[model samples]
Target: MQSVVEQFKQTYGRLNARSLGLLAELYTDDVLFQDPFRRLEGLGALTRYFAELYAHVETCSFTFEDEVVQSQQAVLLWTMSLRHPRLNGGQPVVVPGSTHVRFRHKIYFHRDYFDAGAMLYEHLPLIGMIVRFVKERV
Candidate 1:
């Protein structure tokens, strides 16, 4: 179990299109994964979701900062560096987030918490200005 968490950290930190095939090793067949904008169930759906996600992606990577593992659950703090054609004119975008994962032999549930405004809304043009203005005032 300890090894599984370590493996997940390593694999996830290096995640890319090529490493995506290895999801089966770290997640169960009926895995549940969710983030700010998407919720996916089952490994197959998760795979497809990732495929579409990286379709227009230029580069994506993660850096794991901290983790707490207990029983069958683990919480991970990470910062993601992402570059996509549609966002920020393909420049790198850094978003800090945390993941909560529960596993048996493999991870069965995973959830990520992060600011959508930082990831998307604040990256737009006109809307970005408005979003940032509101955020600063709040």
Candidate 2:
């Protein structure tokens, strides 16, 4: 089980369009994946979702900082360093988040928790300033 969790982290950290085919090994056929932006059901949908996410991305990588495993579930804390053409002036931006995964033989469900503003909203031009201001106030 812990091995599965490690594989999950390593696989995702190096994930790319070409490597998307590896999803079959890390997820079940009916895997459910959700994040602040969208919810994807099934391995096929997951592939498409990732394709779109990385379309404009220049580079993206993840670093797992912490983890906790119990039974069929695991929680992993990670920071994603991403560089995209339309975000943050194409410079790398880091966003901290966590994922909760449940699996039997392979991951059947995965949920990601992160601030959308930090990953997207705060990287916009005008909206970025406003979002940053609001975040500072909070």
Candidate 3:
């Protein structure tokens, strides 16, 4: 049997609008998912969130780097390459992030850590300039 962590990586790598159904295989019915932007509870909400997210993206993919696992918890480091027509001029934006997940047969809790500015704000036109300036000054 494939470990949940490996299953998660595989499922997310191929996840898209069409592949949203795969989420059911990785997450429990009442799973809790949180990221920098929002917190979601239940698999239904998560599916809607991803649907909206993927609807606007031209392409998105993750490259898993490292993982630490113990008991029923795991932390996986990854870099996401995303392309959105409204952000970064439809070019790819690479954001480094990590996921912490707790699972039994399927993941029931998940949290993601990443720089929201790098993923969104820094990719916008006007906001991108301001964010970059602020970072440089800081």
Candidate 4:
């Protein structure tokens, strides 16, 4: 059995689109992914979700700084960097988050985490304004 840290260490670190595809190979057809805005099920849905995110950013990558890996459960402490031309190119929007995965032997059953606001909405111009307004008002 690959440890949680090992799975991440082997897949991430030098992340690219191809690496993303490789990681998806570890997800089952019925994978479940959760985040601030979306609770998506199945690897197909997960792939589409990730693809849409990649479309908006010039470059995207992740680095795992800390981790806690058990037999079937793993938690990764990491930061995702995205280069948004509208926000600031190459400025790197660093959002610290964790991906908690439940492993079904070699594939993932559940994999999810992260703050959407910090990673996305806060980095947009008009969108950021709306987020701030909504936060302040609500």
lDDT of 3 by residue, 1-138 (tens): 999999999998899899999999999999999999999999999999999999988889999999999999999999999999999999999999999999999999999999999999999999999999999999
Residue 14 shift from truth in candidate 1, angstroms:
2.8
Question: Model 1 TM-score?
Answer: 0.90
For every candidate, C-alpha RMSD to the true structure in Å: 1.7, 1.5, 0.6, 2.8
Structural similarity to truth (TM-score) of each candidate: 0.90, 0.93, 0.98, 0.78
lDDT of 4 by residue, 20-125 (tens): 5865656778877788778888888877877776665677778778878787787878888878776643478888888888876555565557778777787787
What's model 3's overall lDDT? 0.97
Candidate 1, residues 26-71, lDDT tens digits: the string is 9999999999989999999998888887777778888899999999
lDDT (Cα, 0-100) at 40 in candidate 4: 88
Candidate 3 wrongly placed segments (more than 4 Å) = none
Identify the candidate with maximal TM-score: 3
lDDT values of the candidates? Answer: 0.88, 0.91, 0.97, 0.72
How do the residues 29-66 of candidate 2 rate in per-residue lDDT, one tens digit apiece? 99999999998899999999998888778889998999
Q: How accurate is candidate 2 locally (lDDT)?
A: 0.91
Judged by lDDT, which candidate is best? 3
Q: Once superposed on the true structure, which residue ranges of model 1 sit more than 4 Å away at CA?
A: none
